[model samples]
Target chain A: MHEMALMGDILDIIMKDAESKGIKQFSRIDLIVGELSNAMPDALTMAFEIYKEQNAQLFTKDASLHIQFEEAISECIFCKTVYKPDFKISICPSCHMPSGKLISGETFQVLSYEGE
Target chain B: MEVKLNTNVLTNNNVAADYNRDLFHKTKTLVINVMSSPGAGKTTLLEETIKKLSKQYRIGVIEGDLATEKDADRIRQLGAKAVQINTHGGCHLDARMVVATLPEFDFEEIDILFIENVGNLVCPSGYDLGQNHKVAVLSVPEGNDKIPKYPQMFMRTELVLLNKVDLLPYLDFDVETAKEDLKGINPESTLLPLSAKTQEGMDSWYSWIDEAYQACLKQ
Candidate 1:
């Protein structure tokens, strides 16, 4: 859905960051997409592929997008138990209380990019 | 050479959100970000909420839509200053877009700024528009499964306005089950059943807004 907007921003960031570093082309780009960020990796990769094919000046010939998905984590308020949610179910197994606080999982960041 | 740039992809949007938050704090304006699925009676709820609260508070609206300015137009017809941010096929409204529209409103005269986010449950929940409260409108027609199906929306929001409740009798919808489902996902969140069309259960919504406005004044 909104993966296109995210991919657009990712491409912009990469191009600007790479340009400042005097890197003409990137051999690889590494991204860490949090499970709770609501972005689809397949859609992001598809957008990257399309952008790479169209915008030749922005990347090298064999540049690849490496994505690592981080599991969404939440914590129980009552028992203070931290757990990874199964299919976005935020609940404490021990106390059967909802994990009202989300510790992490809405992270959309570029970890690093390899370039010449 | 591999560069070590552990940068947030949404850094720009986050920065914009921070800026908007600061402005709201300075103005002491209570901002509410309203989100829901398409055709979930979000606009209708807002229109009703405005009709009830406008006499007591100076209200301004920021309508986010993909194509037209219809929602903003509706708010303007109610005699409130409204600015529309058309994403032009974009799925959601970011903080940057909200910041760009700030100049359109005279913040000093406005008491409440209600941002009706684009009618999508998933993408809009992820973006923070620097609002004091995030309210999700889940109409009864959307079914009982939406609370569990779209947990993120209910999880992020502090209040869930169960709109279109007048149709509850005709439709096979259970208010109690919806409340239970929301509790499983977001225990801190409160579910308020109301119908904008029939003005049923709208007083609770008005009271919530009044309390939010009072809280904003304290800050």
Candidate 2:
């Protein structure tokens, strides 16, 4: 639901980074989101579509945005066990103790962007 | 050309949060960001807390809702400063929203500031509003599955206030199981059982606030 706001930030970052590099336009924007981050990639893509249409002058008119997801993985600090829970339970499979230290799947980052 | 730019999507939010943190530190204000599912008794608990702490401390509240002045009105009825932020349809209140409300508070006169985040188990936990502590409220009727189902919320908060404990006798909810579940998700977090309506087991909450305030002073 907050994808619009996040999309706006993503655009700002892309624009700022592009300006610093003296790039006129980019052909693709690559984004990475984690499963645990609660970000819906479809919604984010929709938001970027609207944002891109509104700011056509900022980038190549046909540039596309792509988002990749990272699966959520939890690690048990007690037994050094790493596993993926069903997003409902963080209990370590071996120890049966709750472990919520997430090593991945919460990544929300701009991995890269292609330029003309 | 492909430019590899690995940067956080929420960098802007984090920068705004840091700004709010600096202001909080300079004013020596104890700010607590409270989160929960809707109807989890967050506002009721805040109302009672304000009434009890008003005599000893000057309190202010920043109420975040989709659209409503009702919460701020309730806090104002207690004769404390309360400002309301309407997110329209937004699920969470971001750091910029809190920064915008900073001027509304007289930081020097306000000893404590409570930000009642927009009620939702998932969204509110991700954004940092530059508070001293993050507290989550869970009620008896919301069921035990909430703690595990919404692990993100419980995992991030330091304290979980199990509200509506007075209804324990009528409901099948187990306080011990809830406590154990919270420990499983967050071993360092504390689960405090209390009923805002009955005012049962509120002393520990007050003591916790007092200790937090004292720690704020030292900072």
How do all models score by TM-score? 0.95, 0.94
Model 1: runs farther than 4 Å from truth? A77-82, A99-101
Give model 2's TM-score versus the native structure. Answer: 0.94
Docking class of 2: medium
Question: In lDDT terms, how accurate is model 1?
Answer: 0.88
Question: Global lDDT for candidate 2?
Answer: 0.90
Worst 10 residues of 2 chain A by lDDT: A82-91
Candidate 2: residue B53 Cα off by (Å): 0.8
C-alpha DockQ for predicted model 1: 0.68
Q: What fraction of the reference structure's interface contacts does model 2 contain?
A: 0.75
Candidate 1, clashing residue pairs? none
RMSD of 1: 1.7
lDDT of 2 by residue, A1-116 (tens): 78998888887887798888888777799999998787889999999889878877766778898988898888887898888866434578898877647788888999998875
After aligning candidate 2 to the native by TM-score, how far in Å is the CA of A29 from where it should be?
1.0
Weakest 10 consecutive residues of candidate 2 chain B by summed lDDT = B179-188
